[model samples]
Target: MSFLQLLIIAIVQGVTEFLPISSSGHLILIPKLMDFPDQGPLIDVAVHVGTLAAIVSYFWRDVWGLARGGFASVGIGTAPAERRLFWYIMAGTVPAVLVGLFLKTGGYLEGFRSTTLVAINLIVYGVLLGIADRFGAQRKSFEELTLKDAVIVGLAQALALIPGTSRSGVTMTAARFLGYSRFESARFSFLLSIPAIAGAGLLAVLDLADASARMQSDAITAGALTFVAAILTMVFLMNFLKRASMMVFVVYRVAMGVALLLFFA
Candidate 1:
């Protein structure tokens, strides 16, 4: 891929990573449509690493609070709110990790390369998010989010490994389904992504470690660009999603899905 191609992919990575669209699905489809060979490890890692950085930077305060709470939980200094939140995040993260492992290790999500499946998943999940948001009880806040609820939300996040199933989409959908207000749902979804995305990025890094020698290739350049794009994308979405309707994302996913089907097939 040329610098331009990498830049384009980076933009896709950034925008989709947080906007309730499927970054992986777009990455796959873009290459297929352009007849580019399978994207390389460098690009994937770069964009994700960038995203990781973005998330950490954006939520440093929350992350710090969580970390402090975690440490305090073992001592006598922790506030009840901090202790509760720390445990809740851990509770939520477990199901997400387990689900991700089951799907990845069990071959349930091996269809990431299939554009048709991705397109279908995108439209279906997008619709689900919209519907869930519309009908959600919208009564809960992050403070009120329960461990039981967190685990279920995490389970929903696990499904995001499938291309077209946005991690944020599913998490927020689950939150809304369980009665979170839009802001609360969106906030928790982003919070939930911190651990899941971190784990995924770490896994990707480990996988890429075996290929670091090729980091000088064009693909690496593409990956760096993608990373920059991913960072900016996360920043924009986290800010914009404060009041954005889930329907807006749904339309984009459906349109993109149709486009993928028409053009890639």
Candidate 2:
């Protein structure tokens, strides 16, 4: 890919990956609209790595805590909040993993990338997020998270297998609906993403191996740029959610969805 193409792809992947906008949807639409060549497997893997690195870097403290807590909990038992949170993240990942495995095995996920389906989901889930944010009790924080919360959020994440459903968006919506505060809801969502993103990257790596995919000439440059963009976007989004509601994202999703439908229709 050209430098300009990489720049655009990096920006879209970085922003939408965390902003409650669908990264997969944007990646599909933007390239089509701009008439760019297919990004191919190497670029896909690079961007995935970039976003994964961003999330991991941003949440390193939590990642460390989870690692230590998980190991210790295996022996002494999981009694501390950090240890419990570790387990909670694991619990939250199960539903999505199971659902993703099923979809992959059945070759169902690729077909769901239809523009019409993406447009419909964009509007539908946008409204769902708005409703949850507007009416949710907003009384809970990360410290107060429970097993039930994780499972419900995890189940919601399963729906995100569909293009435009947005893994972050659905999980945050579920967390909000379960009464978590906006920032804390987002925190949990981001934390939950670590395993999910890692799993996805691993799958992509295996696919690359199977296909004997070769890296683009500028793959390193593209990956580095994407990583920088993703990290900045991740930081900005986490801070933004701390003070704002999901209303802006809701409006954006709905508007984009409508535009997409009109254009495609």
Candidate 3:
């Protein structure tokens, strides 16, 4: 990929990864629309690693707590709230990991990357998110999350394996429907993503074990660039949700989906 292509991938992935928009959908569309060479799974892994790092950095406190809690659950210490949350996250991650492994090994994942499929999902799931945000109660906080809530959101996240379903979007939509506030919803979604992204990246790395040096260099560069963009995006988004609704993202998703449908038609 050229510098411009790399930059565009970084910006798009970084900006859309945490938002209620689908980064994978945009990444898939860009190469098809612009006739750019596919950056391949290596670059995909690189950008994912970058965003993973960003979320981890931004939520280091939560990560640390989760770590301690994880240990505690195994009888190392006692952190009731943290231990509960740690287990909840583990339980939540199960559905997606199982589904992803099935799709990957079955060679069925790539078939869902069609632009029409992406467009439909973008519109449908976006509207679902809008409805959840508009009508769902918002009285719950992060600490109030239940095991049922985490499992439900995790199942919803499994749907994001399809292009344009938007992992963050679906998880947040689920959280909202469960009556959590936007900030708390987004926080849980972001935290849930740590394991998801890491799992995906590990799979991709297995494919790149024999990649060329130049490809490795490009991956490193893309990762660094995406890390910068992703962290900034994470900061902006967390703060923005504190005082705003997600209607703007809903509108954008609908408009973009409509445009893609028309263009593809």
Candidate 4:
């Protein structure tokens, strides 16, 4: 890819990664529709690491608390908010990590055509989201999230491996359905993403090492650019998420899905 393509891909990765629209889905569908190579496995990891840095920077306070809480829970130290949420985030991540391992290595996420399935899921999930908010306007905040709810949300997150299911969207939707407020649901979704994305990125690093023996310097540089883009995306999404309406994202997802379907057809 040219520097311009690298920059554009990074920007798109950063923005769409946080949006309710599926980032991974976009990585697949956008390339096919626009006639570009699907970004390589190593690049996926690199971009994820960039996003991880962004989330950690933005939510350092929460990260500290979760760390303190996680430590304390193990009888090491004391931090209050750190207790359940720390563990809950960990619990929520387990299913996705497991599923990701199997699918990533088992060839489950291959075939560019799966993006069509993703687009379909995006449309269907968008409708479900509207119905969910209409009927399940939650008054409870993230503070009220239970271990059970966290686990369920995590499971929903695991299903986001499907092209258009969207990790953030699915997790937020599930949280809302379980009685969490929109802001809380959104916050928790982002929080949960930290570990999941980080884990994925770490895996990519290993793959990149092997690829480095065969891949050119330019490929590595491109991946670095993608990583930078992911970081910017995480920053923009987290802040905008605080104020953006679900309606906007819902409309976008539906429109993107429809566009993909038509274009592919």
Clashes per prediction? Answer: 3, 0, 0, 3
The residue-by-residue lDDT of candidate 2 on 1-265, one tens digit each, is: 6789988888888888788988777877766789988775456556767888887888898788888768867786554878888888899899989998898899786687588888988999999999999999879997787899988998998898887988789889999999998888888888888788788778876665555323544555566788889898888888898788899999999999999999999
Q: Model 1 over residues 1-265: C-alpha lDDT tens digits?
A: 5666767777878778777787777777777777776665456656766666666777788787787888889995767787788888888888778877777687665456798889898889988988997788867888787889888898898787777788878888899899988777877887887777788777776666676465546445655565576667666665675757678888888888888778667
lDDT of candidate 2?
0.83
Candidate 2 deviation (Cα RMSD): 2.1
Off by over 4 Å in 2: 40-42, 76-79, 211-213, 216-222
Question: Cα deviation of 124 in candidate 3 (Å)?
Answer: 0.3
lDDT of 4: 0.75
Arrange candidates by lDDT, descending. Answer: 3, 2, 1, 4
lDDT values for all models: 0.76, 0.83, 0.91, 0.75
Per-residue error (Å), model 1, residue 207: 2.4
- The candidate 2 region of ten consecutive residues with least summed lDDT is 210-219
lDDT of residue 9 for candidate 2: 85
lDDT comparison, 3 vs 4, better candidate: 3
- Model 4 superposed RMSD (Cα): 2.4
Per-residue lDDT for 241 in model 4?
47
Best candidate (score: lDDT)? 3
Better by TM-score, candidate 4 or 2: 2
* Prediction RMSDs, each to the true structure: 2.6, 2.1, 1.1, 2.4
